[model samples]
Target: MVFEDLGIMPAILEALKGEGYINPTPIQEKAIPILIKGKDLQGCAQTGTGKTAAFAIPILQRLSQNPLQKQGPKPIRTLILTPTRELAIQIGESFASYGKNVNINHTVIFGGVSQGAQVDALRRGVDIVIATPGRLIDLNNQGLVALNKIEIFVLDEADRMLDMGFVNDVKKIIKLIPKHRQSIFFSATMPDSITQLASSILTQPQYVEVTPVSSTAETIAQELYFVDMVNKRDLLLHILKDKELKSILVFTRTKHGADKVVKLLERESIKAAAIHGNKSQNARQKALNDFKDKKLRVLVATDIAARGIDIDELELVINYEIPNIPETYVHRIGRTGRAGQIGKAISFCDSDERIYMRDILKLTKINIPVANEHPFLPAEGNTDLSTAVKPKAKAPLPRENRPRNHAYGSTSKGGNGQRKRENSF
Candidate 1:
């Protein structure tokens, strides 16, 4: 349905028009009306589903309708808690963009940087505050933030926050808010823990499930390359060299791996950047901004750092290393194929990652095509086909001594020796 039919105000409608958002997404269509009614909500939709606007628009409209009159730097009236710094910033941007024509003051806070600026912003008074859990707790503990006046509380990406071990922090933050306030919980998936948490926080809330749990977007072309670990980087470089690949997102399992991948790509004179927890906030943001502007051809990111990357027309997502958690596979691929646009997700799987691939297929109930003939795969005679045979389960190696079969070489070994070990192990 058109956004106008949803009863959004003239200013908001104008803002939407300027932003070229004429219609609402499925999640937005269902959740916006329910949210505007001032009822608690439990939203089930993946990232890039326009879920941010679903809540942002309603919240902004509600706040505008009932402007706070508190004198000294109006205390925070609405609080939004997100899982990662990047997501928190993106949500704040959504609020700013939608509320540009309306009169609303919002600020975002997160760690990985100094707190002086965030503290100063809070002191100046903001109507809405978007923050990561850790930084939010820190500010609250330091008496810089006041949640007693909160009218609406949002827990965005609740499942990811829980996965990042923020349940205790979330519980503590909830206790600080008034029990009478409206609470909203949005997530991509609904595991038992998140479901139980939602049940406890929401009181007869309007339930919205635009997409099924553990499902990937239908527009993405999913494929898996059965390649030896040693060749994954070379294969990635080859794909990046293609003139058709305008922009690409690459996912690695760890921050070090992401950095190493970026370094290797740079060594090949390919413009790339890496973002993860270890990077400074400015660095992460710069990389993200560059990638979005097409100033950088590739961006390698870890799972946690890649949240809230709302790039339209992202054509490719390369899984440099398969995620152990099946649900993460869905999230990684969701970065591409956004807004009904066709995209491609290419996953690199070694002999040991077959089980991980199987688990992801079982969870999503979709069998990705096996692409064994990709340039990333070894020559026919070079591959050890015996590794694929059953009845000979390989024994697990010690974690420290385990082969570094990642997208880039690790410190455990260097040069061609590591490649030899990777092929033989």
Candidate 2:
């Protein structure tokens, strides 16, 4: 449905139209009205679902309707906590973009850069603040910012925050804010911990869930390449050589791996960048900007680095390393196929990662088609796909080494059909 149908202000609707957002995403459609009603909400939707706008629009409209009372320098009326600096910046941009026509002042704060600029912004007084948890805590502790006057509190990417070990920090921040304020928590996955956290914070909140946990977008075409780990880089290089790959996001399991992947690609004369926890905020932002501008061919990132990458027309996502957590597989592939656009997710799985691949399939309930014709595959030399051997099963240990006693105090008899002692000790 259109944004205007949600009862958004005419000015806000005009701003959305100017920004080319004519219709609301499913999450936005379900959330905007409830949010405008000034109620707490718990939203479960995957990334790239326009969740930022869902809350931003309603918040701007609400704040514009009831202007904050001026008491000395105005404290932040709205606080939005995100897991990463990139997401904080993105959410801030969304607020600024959608609230441009409206009379809302917003600022974003995160670490890895000078606090002087952020301090300046806070000094000037902003109506809304989007920030990373650590930086928010730091600014609060320094007495540069206060949350006591906050009217609305948002925890975006709640699962990612929990994954990054921000639960305690989140709790601390929540305690600092006014208890009576409206709270909204949005996450792609709702594990038990997230559920418990939400229950503790929200009071009779409206629950909006558009997708199941650990489920990948249906528009994505998933495929797997059974390649040797050593040849993964070569396979990636070959894929990048294709002219069809417009903008690619390559996911590595570790920060070091991301850096190495970027270095390798650069050595091959491919323009690429890496973003992770180790990189300074400036470097990460520059990389992201370059990738968005299409000046960079690829962006290699760890899961954390890629947490809030919302790029439209992202043509592909390559799993340089399969994630151990099945849910992470869904998040990684979600980098592409965003905003209802068709995309491709290609995974490079070696023999050791076959089990990981299976777990991902079971979680997402989508069988990724296996491709044995990739250049990295041993059978690629022969066009006959039948010659490719299936992955071999791991050999079992010797019989003597096997555990003799069962948990039920029973043991398998030998050829003599005799019972063994329950305990070998």
> Using lDDT as the measure, which candidate wins?
1
Q: Write the per-residue lDDT of candidate 2 for residues 36-137, one digit (tens) a residue.
A: 999999999765566878998899899999986656766789999888765664565566556667777777777766678788888878788888788789
RMSD of 1: 11.4
Q: Tell me the whole-model lDDT of each prediction, alpha carbons only.
A: 0.77, 0.76
Q: Which stretches of candidate 2 lie over 4 Å from their true place?
A: 69-72, 212-222, 226-234, 240-345, 348-360, 369-425
Q: After superposition, which runs of candidate 1 have C-alpha atoms over 4 Å from their true positions?
A: 190-192, 213-222, 226-233, 240-345, 348-360, 369-425
lDDT by residue for model 1 (107-220), tens: 777776667778877887788888888878988888888999899999998988887788998999999999888889998889999999998788889899885448888999
Clashes of 2: 0
Say which candidate scores most in TM-score.
1
Candidate 1 C-alpha error for residue 10, in Å = 2.0
